[model samples]
Target: MSSAPSSTVFLASPDADTPAAAQALATIRERVLAATARGTPLDIQGGNTKRWYGQTPAGEPLDMRMYRGIVSYDPAELVITARAGTPLAEIEATLAERGQILPFEPPHFGPGATLGGCIAAGLAGPRRPHVGAPRDFVLGAVIMNGQGQVLHFGGQVMKNVAGYDVSRVLAGALGTLGVLLELSIKVLPCPVAEATLRFALPQAQAIEQLNRWGGQPLPLMGSAWHDGVLHVRLGGAAAAVAAARATLGGEPVDAMEAHAFWQSLREQSHPFFANAPLMGDGQPLWRLSVPPTTPPLAHSDEHLIEWGGAQRWWITPRAAADVRAIAAAAGGHATLFRHGDKLAGVFTPPPAALRAIGERLQHAFDPSRIFNRQRLYR
Candidate 1:
């Protein structure tokens, strides 16, 4: 193991490395283990889109940006493996060529989002509830734990999560558990064709429509957050989509329109981003994931509850106490997705057991607390 500096200013720079699979793995493992020994934390960053998330920390960021690229793509198996630092756009393009997709509905801000960041955040677009979360398709990973020891979890062969399920456990873990060097994810083949249906319905009616479609085999690629319109995307065989379209009365929007709509929803652009100019000094953006059947818009007055009914994006200038209360009432987890403050907590209340488990895992991987110390769990 190599010993590097205790800490370095961790923004716009990262612990660098090459894109080669072996080289990337070696560098990440070395940096994380060293971080643990030095008792220095790391600031894990991607395209830096969600940099404002939670409380920002001061430490050496084990920047994964340097280790990037697709490692392997097996079209027959529908599994794609890539370095953690590989850009999401690159992943999508690779999958598109093979006629396969992530199916978890990953959103890319630009040419910057890395595969590692997506897994750590567990971000899924409107199609999440229907298919699954980022973890559902997660097959395996090669990670550098906090202890500076490299560990591989899950398996390349399908249906092979034999013993401990560390791969699934790390989803949405915010790099608190370990540093993902490379990941092997089960993918889905792309459909032959796809289309979306836009219906103008009130909030209640939209909810009902979504539930109805959920019961049926409508290939819902994405839905929701259209100013006042309820947009439901259907993807699959052209025959299937056409049949579904015949039953409904909707003017088919072109592929361009549909793609643009989904991309916006993927990144939470509409409604919230619309007020960018009006936002002064930057208030925080809170994301709440609620059940579809919540009290009919109890907090509707304060925030914009979109995505059928599950995901919500609340932009408030109020205090954190008020936001947490609303999320608790709505039945979901509250996360400071984007904020101006560098010291405010990103997540609401993490369960005691979960926190304890996280701490133990952190220690196991990084005994020295080398990576992002107290940034997530503190």
Candidate 2:
């Protein structure tokens, strides 16, 4: 375990507090207010790396890359606050310098990926199941609502809350709720030691084995199955990793290869994703998230099972309804992760009650519906 320093560290340079940064923020707020007054929609953009994700962006672009930098860091407290436009790589590198990390392992789809976009997309990597999701790490946020008023939620530290944690709400809201300004996020110590093991097993056997091991006190940090091979990553104290490795027998994977494999899985740069057709091409990539215990769905080639079998990716030309039905039947949902016919919808529709709640939240946060309108729902 890692501990924070007694006092918080102000990571911002003079540049962060300079008039330029302030002016950038003011410019964004003014734009929002002007858009609201004129009844115009604003497409909130950060890096535009994931611009193709979710519904098509509407309204005039509100570029956010200008307002960026780390605001503060508390290593002992394991919290970091930064402007929404701060590059994700910068934050990760900063955390890495101190042997800390965002445990959820967010994916940077492109070099230009930003903190705001990471939260908006809310996509986690292979380590998610062993740790948690993006929402789980969010401590607080500063956002500009439809009225252009900045609203703050949560704080620098974690505590029990009676109602909705608005900070977490913004995690996957796709900026539909408001304009993400700055965010405080919880981080964790990087594993002290790590290793990957390989197993040859069928999908059913792999799922069963992973679930079985999941119930045990193993240092399982990441797991993935593709092309009849299952790779499990063990991380923790050296003794713990060694003990787990000895207990769970599998061929050892080279350290560098293991790192590259997990990175590929995290970035979706693996051959499975590479082989998938582009949006207008023949086939599209689909991500099916079901219970870890759920049996494998009937699917064709070029598929990868990850998160201990809870998150599966497949490349297919299947109908949207058919793919969604399969996931729903398994008590989960399917997302057209990339390169798909989005007119049929990229995400499964929320149930009526959930949809109603979302609608209410949207209305409450952006009555003018001026912020990234229909980015999530549509």
Candidate 3:
């Protein structure tokens, strides 16, 4: 839960200081209307944890903190519908009672994160490659577009095809597109057992090993690198996992320990985050996505590589030019994910055609571009 430190900080989702009521939706719509009439950018925000991921918006910031709750859930249908501002943890907890889980394995991202924020940012955790990305499971959304008019896409029904799939498109639009009100998505049953294995291998060696093993038969959920260590998690029937582990040659760590390990890894809570005399001061974190075949970073720095080597979470204190240079050399691009906004191009700049389409959509939805205009696209 988030506590409102001041008017400038309207904390949303599991707010420790504030529990948004059902009226938060009306309040949000009202504020949005006011902003549209005034033509001032609204500071669209959800989770502060991922705030450092991209460019800081320039606006009077809009926080969706007041709108939070699960609207409905059906265990038989394996679908859970909730308000946009519902905390992901709450949704997952509710689903757990029915033995269903978010197939995407979306990161809870602490208390302040909201379902709307997660979808808007298209944020995913280490399990993404195996389960699916955030947007993949997003079924529908009720949003208040730039004009403060409510809109719908998809629906609660899984077989729905009533309209354009702008629902998924809105997933990573970063609120520059529209303000999400409520969303419905599919959920899955949690695996019976889970385990994570960590190996102290050099980056190049680990890359080679994973590439080779990737060709073999095994249940590999996802892999990531933090500092100089490689961590891999496996989930499924307990028998298969045990067989896979025995053949993989990594020491086995049970579910409880693996959970703690992943939590620490995801939040940068391990020795990787510690101050070491040998490493000097650590640098900012950059999230890079590229082809898995891209060579290991030649730069002298630590990286947390995930998604079967397709994602590079590089940590270094390099200038924007240098970061972009590395990304180009590796046939990919970079965005500042943590500790550095100076080097990021927020919201992963889209292709020219997409940008034009985005602008057109932005104009059509928000004629004044008054909703978080300065936060994402700009």
Candidate 4:
């Protein structure tokens, strides 16, 4: 598993700001205005770990790390707001103190991961099938459009639904829509009890069992099947976990090992991913999202399935078109996740109607097309 250094910096309160942070915000606004005036694009950046993702960035770098700090956090209300540049480690540490979490289990990828980058990437971990995705938890956001105007959408409380859809749209826009400034995200308390079980079943059998169990009430937190074993995690109330554990007969896994194993999967440090760099030349990591009930695709030695079969990861030297064709035939799309010849394409192109809607939104939010231009598409 990949072990990266953890960020030790404790973020300051949202209400308090150092002089340097104020200057950073003002400087960013100025840069946005100038870029809009010149019709030049600005490549919004954070941490730089995920730079390899998406299309090749095309614009002057706009570092967001300078504008950092928590804006507000109310543990009782289960809500936290922080600047886009605030380090994700800091936020997680703060939330852990209150026995709460982001629920979506966003992967850090690297120690320098920032809130803005997390929202821009909009990736969810193993728990996604149980709880929700990143966009679902986003309560609101403050964004700076191409006109250098700051726009606010949604609100802190869950009941505040006005403009909520607009706020959620910024979750995975990759900064193509606008520069994400601050975000208010809903949080959830940590589960009271948790347990991990192991079932030595083949891929097809595992998928069938997962889908069957998915229909009944159970505290299914996360699941993964690779090689010959399927691992399942149960969480929530102690009684519920125990009841489910008794019902689902399987070998038990040590608590510590289970935590580490799940963490490895969330951070993409599992053995499956750790071997990606060594998967031979031209081999790229492909993420396939299909119906949970969809049968397995063509077998590969490096295949790993997660999210109850909804998300599958495979590394192969197959041509991009061939890989996409297989995924499409299975009723889903494919993403060129990592280490590939992206000249062909990183994401499967959206349908015409979806593409048109995206264009209209881009025009409405960034008419100048000066924010991370071509980052999401050509």
Among the numbered candidates, top TM-score falls to: 2
What is the C-alpha lDDT profile of model 2 across 1-378, one tens digit per residue?
Answer: 345466766677423476878898789989999999999899999988888778788999999999898899988888999999999999999888778999999988789999999998888988899899999888888888988787888887887342228889888889999999988899999898999999999999999999999999999999999888999999999999999999999999999999999999888778777766333344678889999999878766568999988998888888899999989999999998777688999888989999999999999989999999888766
Screening candidate 2 with a backbone cut-off below 3 angstroms (N, C-alpha, C), the clashing residue pairs are 3-76, 4-76, 4-77, 5-76
Cα lDDT tens digits, model 1, 268-309, are 565555543222455667777778766455555335545567
Clashes per candidate (backbone, < 3 Å): 12, 4, 9, 2
Quote model 2's TM-score.
0.95
Off by over 4 Å in 3: 1-22, 273-282, 341-344
Work out the TM-score per prediction.
0.86, 0.95, 0.86, 0.94
* Tens-place lDDT digits, model 3, residues 38-96: 87888777765456545666687677756767766766666677777778778777777
Q: Per-prediction RMSD in angstroms?
A: 8.1, 2.3, 7.3, 4.6
lDDT of each: 0.70, 0.87, 0.71, 0.89
Looking at model 1, residue 77 earns an lDDT score of: 69
Full ranking by TM-score: 2, 4, 1, 3
Q: Candidate 1 regions off by >4 Å?
A: 1-24, 276-281, 300-306, 340-344
Query: Rank order by lDDT, top first?
Result: 4, 2, 3, 1
Q: In model 4, which regions exceed 4 Å deviation?
A: 1-18, 277-282
Best by lDDT: 4
